[model samples]
Target chain A: MSENRVPEEIQENAAHEAAKLGIGTDEWVAQHEERTARKKGLKGVPQFIDESIPAWARWVVLLAAAFAFGAFVDNQYLLRIGVNLGLFVMLSYGLNIVMGYAGLLDLGYVAFYGIGAYGYALMSSEQLGHHWSTWLSVLIIIIGTALLGYIVSLPARRLFGDYLAIVTLFFGQVFVQLVLASDNITFPWADDYVDITAGANGIPGIDPFSFFGHKFLNIRDYYWLLLVLVALLTITISRINRTRIGRAWRTIREDALAAESMGVMVNRLKTMAFVTGAAIAGLAGAIFAAMQSAVFVSGFDMPLMTMIYAAVILGGSGSLAGAVMGAIVMSVLPEVLRVTNYSEILFLAVLVLTLAAVGKSVKRFTINIVSIALIGFAVKILLGFASIKITPTEEWVVGPVSRALSHWMYVPLDRVLWGNCAFVILIVLIAYFTTTTPRIKTILLPIIGYLGIFLWEVRLVTDVNTTRQLLIGAMLVVLMITRPQGFLGKPRVEVL
Target chain B: MSEKKPLLEISNIDTYYGVIHILQQVNLRVDEGELVCLLGGNACGKSTTLKTILGMVKPKVGKIMFAGEDVTHQNTPARVKLGMAVVPENRRLFGPMTVLENLKIGAYVRGEAAQEDLERVYDLFPKLKERSSQLAGTLSGGEQQMVAVGRALMSHPRLILMDEPSMGLAPKLVEQSFEMIANLHSQGVSMLIVEQNANMALSVADRGYVLQTGRIVLEGEAKELAGHEELRRAYLGR
Candidate 1:
C-alpha cells in the first residue's frame, strides 16, 4: 500500500556490508519486524522504543514500575517472589560484569554468593557465640568477598581460553565439597573436634539488616531494600562502564591481544572485573540469607547458579537493564508454575503469545488456535466412543479455565505414567515439527499443541520443580536463537 | 643513514606457529618520521612481523630495538607503553564502544593526558568529532579506518604501525585513506604500514620491503620497487 521510507540504495548498502562481514542475513525478530512494519506503512512498536525513549529513561521507568509493584502488592507469596527477583537482578548484574563486560566465564561465581551467605550467617547468628551488628557483618562480607575474588583470580592469570574454565569450574566444585564435609575439625593438640560450619544442618537464625535500629522484618522490607540497592548498583555500574577501567574491559572483551597492544592492562582489568562480580554476588547472598534467616549449602548449588546465569543470558549480558528484565521474568515464572491454576493460565498465555508472534499473519494465528481446540475435542470424542471416561483429579482443577477445559479435553484419570508417555511423544513431535515443510508444519502444529496441553494438565503442571527447569532451559534456547545479545545488550560482532 | 639509529629495528627474527615456521630470518626497520611499507601477499609473514614487533609473537631468535633499547622480550602492552601504537588488522576498534571511548582506550597508557590526546585525534579526523557518540561497529568502513588511525594518534606514540588499512574500503576511499596516511607522515609522525594493497601503500611510503614466504626478497625506495616488473606481477597482482 505504501513505498518504504528506507530506500533501495540503503538496503543494498546494508546487504553489501553484511555480506562482507559474512553474516547469514538473519537478524533479530525486533529488528526484522521494524523493517517489515516500515515496508507496510505501519509504525512499529519498537520504533518508538528505539527513537523516543533513551535507554536510561526506559530503565528508570521500568525500575519505577517494579517499585510500584513491590509497594502495593500485599500477598506475602508475591512479595517473596519480588524479593527473590531482586536477588536475581543483583546476581545477574554481578555476573554481567565478569562474563559480559570482561568476557570471563567464571563457573564458580556462585561460590562467592555461598561465601557471602555463610559469612553473614556466621557473623550475625547466635551459633558463633557473639552476634555481630548487621552493618559490620555486611561490610566485612563484601570486603572479604572482594579479597577472595582477587585471590581466586591470581592463579587464572597463567590460564586462558578453556583452561581457565576448567580451573574455575573445579574451584566451584571445591567450594561445595568444603561446605558439605566441613562438619568437624580436629586441630593438633586440641582437646576436641569443633563443628565450624554446623555440619550440613546449615546455620540458621541469621539477623536481618538493621538501619537506624529499624530491622527489616517483612518480605516487603527486603524487597524495598533490594530495590534501592539495585537502583544504586545500576547507576554506579553504568558510570563505571564509561570510565578508563570500563573501556579497558570492553577492549579486552573485543580482542585481548589488540587491547594489550593498545596499552590496556588486560590481566589486571580482568581481575578487577572478577572482584566486582564477586562483591555484588556476595551482597545478594547476604540479603538472601537474611530473608530466610538461614544459610544452607544445598540451596546455594549448581541449579541456583543456572537460574542466575539464565537471567543474565536472557536479559543479555553487559546491560544493567537487560539483567533486571531477565531476572524479573525468570524469578516470577517458577512461582507461577507452583500453583496449578496460575500455571495453566501462564502456559496457555505463553502458547498464545508464541503462536501469535511466530505465525506469518493474524489469520494463520487465529486458524491455528481454532484448529488446536477442534483437534483436542475430536480426540476426546474418539476416546469417548471407546467407552472410556478420562477425568483429571478434581483437587488440582479449581479454576474456571480448568472447568472449561475439562468439558472438552480428555484428562487421564491416572495421569503420571500416561502423562510421561505424552511428554516423550510431545518432545518427538516438536523435534519433527521443526524439520517438516510449511504445509506439513501447519498440519502437525495443532497435534503438537494439543499434546503439549495434555502433558501439562496431566504431568508437567504438577511437577513444579521439573517444569521450572524445563522453562529455564527453553528460555535459554529461545533467547540464544531470537536475541543472542540479550534484550538490552549491544549486538556484538567477532572478526574471527 | 646507517650510523643514525632507526626509530625501530627488527633483525634476524624467526617465529613459529607450533612446529611450522612463520617468519624466517626476517629483518626490517622504520626510521624516525619516515613512512615505510611491508608489502606482501597471503602466507608471507607480513602480519607475524607486526605481531613480533608488538611482542604478541615471541621470536625464537631476534633482536628488536626501539630508540636504541632492546624490546624483543617485552609484552604487547609494554611495547605500546614504550611508544608503539598499532591499528590492528581490520581496524579492531572496540565495536560496542563509542568512537570517543575507542579513542580513550587507545590512550590507555597515558591516563593523565587522555582528554588532551582525544582532542588532538578529533582535530586530525574532524568527521570523527561529529560522530564521536556513535558506536564504532555502526560506522562505515572508511570511517572505521579513520577511527583506527585517530585511535593510534591518541596514544601519542613515537611510531604507529597499521595493518591492511585498505582491505575492505572502495578504491576511491582507499586512495583517500592513503592520502591521509601521506598527510600524517608529512606532519612528522613515523609509521610502518603493513599491507597487501601494494600499489596504494608504495605511493605513500618512503621505503618498501617486499616479503615472500617469511623472508625479505626485495628492499628499496618505494618508487624504485614499484617499478620492478617481476615483483610487481607477484605482489601487486599485475
Candidate 2:
C-alpha cells in the first residue's frame, strides 16, 4: 500500500509546482474532472445503449419479442407482413455478406433469388410435369444457385469496383431477358418452338413446403418457418463473421493488395462470399415461391433489388442486427404508410423528434414550433384576403391531426398542382438553407417546416408509392450527410 | 560473407507497366541472417524491386530464387506462403481493424498457431500489448510503425521486406525504428529494407545497394558505400 501511494514529499512538491504556476491543486483537479465529465456526456444515449447491454442478450430479447408477436398475432395482414419481413431479412443478410463484408457490389443478387424460385417452380410444380419432393427441390436449388454464383464470380475475379457492378447488373438483365424469351425457344435440332418459362405469364400452382404430409398451407405456418430460417441464418452469418474467412473478407474489403500480400486467397474468398450470399438469397427465393404458390418474372426485378440494398445499407451493411432491423423498417414502413392516419402520426412524430434532436436547447425548439404554427396561420389569412377558395376541413382531410390543422393551412381545390409547386419551393428553400449563415438558417427553418407539412398533407400523402420512395430517398440522403457509415457500421478510416 | 547462403536472389529482372520501363535488368540479393538495405532517391525503382521480388509485378526477363527454390512466376499469396512478409509503404495497416487483428492477419498463411509469435511480438513492443484492442488507425505514428513491424514478425518469415519504414515517422522515432531494426538483425532475422534515407539505412545495414534511375550504381559493404565519394555526394549529402 505504501509503495502504491505517492510519497508525501512528492505530493508537496507537486503542490509547490502548482503554486508556482499561479493555480491551486484543487482548482486544476476540478477542471480535469469537468473535462472528463463533459467527454462522458458527449457519448450520450446510443453509447449508453451499446454499453449497458450485451449484444447476445439484446438479440435474445428481440427474437423472443418477435416470436411472441408472431405466435399470438391474429391479423392475417400483419402475419403476411411478418413473413415478408423475414424474407427481406434473409435477402439483406445475403447482400450484407457480399456488399457489407466482402465489399462486392453484386447488383444481380436478386437474379439468384429468381433462379431459386424458378428452379423450385420447375422441380416441384406442374409447369414442367415434374413434382419432386419439396426438400429435394430446395436442396438442389440452393446448390444450383451456389454453383451459378461461383461461375459468375470466375469472370468477376479479375474485375473490381464499378466493373464488377456493371457485369453483375448485365447478368441480371440477361436473366430477365432469358426468362422472357424462354417461352419461345427453338433449338437447332428441334423443328417447333418449345415453351419453357411461360414468358411473362409466369408459373402457377407451385407446391407448398410439406414435411411428412403436414403441408404449410397457412400464412401462419410460413411465418413460423421463415422466422426459424431468419434466426438460423442470423446465427450462422454472425458465426461466419467471427471466423478466419470473415476476417479475410474484411481485409480484402479494406485493401485487396494488402490482403493478398498477407497471404489471404483474395479471389477464392471473394467467390466464397458471393456463393454464400447467393445461396442464402436462393433459399429465401425457394420459400417465397412456396409461400405464394406461384413464380413471376416481375417479382425479381430491379425494384426488389433496390429494396434489399436499401435494407442492407439502412441497417448498416456490415452489422447483423442492423440488416435485420433495416429489413423490418423497409418492409413495414410502406405498409404503415398505406394507412393515412398512421403515416400522418409517424410524420408528425418524426418531425418533432428531428426538431428536438437538432434544436439542442428547449428555447430553440419552442421557438421553432411556434414560428411554424404562426407561419401556417399567416399564410392561411393571406390566402383568405386574396379571395382564394380554401377547401372545407371535412372535404379532403382524413387524419385527426390534418383535420385540426385545416384551420391554419390553406388546402386549395387543385391540391396536386399546389403541392407540386410547394414541393419544388421547399426543395429550393432547403438547399438554400444549407448554404446560408446560421442566423438565416434559423429564420428559414419554420418556413421550410410549414411547407413540408403542406406538401405532405395536400399532395404527398395521396400518392403513397411515390411518397414512400421519396421518403426513403430523403432518409438515405440525410443519413449519408449525418452518418455515412450507416446506423450500425463502424466508421472506416480510408488510407490516404 | 561469400560463404553465406542467399535467402532471396533476383537476377536480370525487367519490369514494365504498359511499355514504360520501371525496372531494367535489376539484380539483388539478401543473404541468410543478413541486414541488406536497398538505397535510392525517389522513383529510382527501389519499390519496384521489392514488388518484383514479392511477385506483385511480373518481370519480363528474370529469375527469382527464394530459399533455394525458383519462384519467378508465383503469385503474391504463394510468395507470402513461402515465408515472406512485408511492412509495405505507408504502413498499409487495416485502419478499421484492431492492432491485434492486423498482427493476426500477418499469420494468415501459417494458420492458427500464432499465439507464441503474438507473445513474442508483445515482448518486443510492450506498448502494443496495452493498445492491442485499439484500432490501428487511431494509433500515433510511432505506435502504428510498431504494429507494422509486429505484424511482419507474426508471420515467422525467413525474410522481411520493408518499404520506407522511416518515411512517416518523427525524426526521433526514426532513430528508434532503426534501433529496433538493429535489435532484430542482432537476433538473426534477415531483412531487405528499401529506403530513400541512405545515411540512416546504411548506419545499421551490413551490406547496401545504391540504385540510380532503375540501375544498381553501387554495391558493397555498408561502410564502403557510406564512404564512397559519389554515393556520399548524391545520397549522404556530405
**Which DockQ-derived CAPRI band holds candidate 1?**
acceptable
Residue by residue across B48-93, what tens digits does model 1's lDDT show? Answer: 9999998888999989999778998888888888899999898887
- Residue runs of model 1 more than 4 Å from their true location after superposition: A1-51, A62-76, A158-162, A189-191, A210-221, A392-396, A494-496, B1-5, B18-21, B112-126, B129-131, B227-238
User: Model 2, range A292-372, lDDT digits (tens) per residue?
Assistant: 899999999999999999888887879998898789889999898878788888888878877776677899999999999
Q: What value does DockQ give for candidate 1?
A: 0.48
TM-score of 2: 0.93
Q: Which ten residues in a row have the lowest lDDT in candidate 1 chain A?
A: A38-47
lDDT of 2: 0.86
Per-prediction TM-score of chain B? Answer: 0.96, 0.98
Docking class of 2: acceptable
lDDT, candidate 1, residue B58? Answer: 95
lDDT of 1 by residue, A264-304 (tens): 88889988998999999899999999998998898878888
Displacement of the residue B189 alpha carbon in candidate 2, Å: 0.7
DockQ for candidate 2: 0.33
User: What is the lDDT, from 0 to 100, of the residue A464 in candidate 2?
Assistant: 79
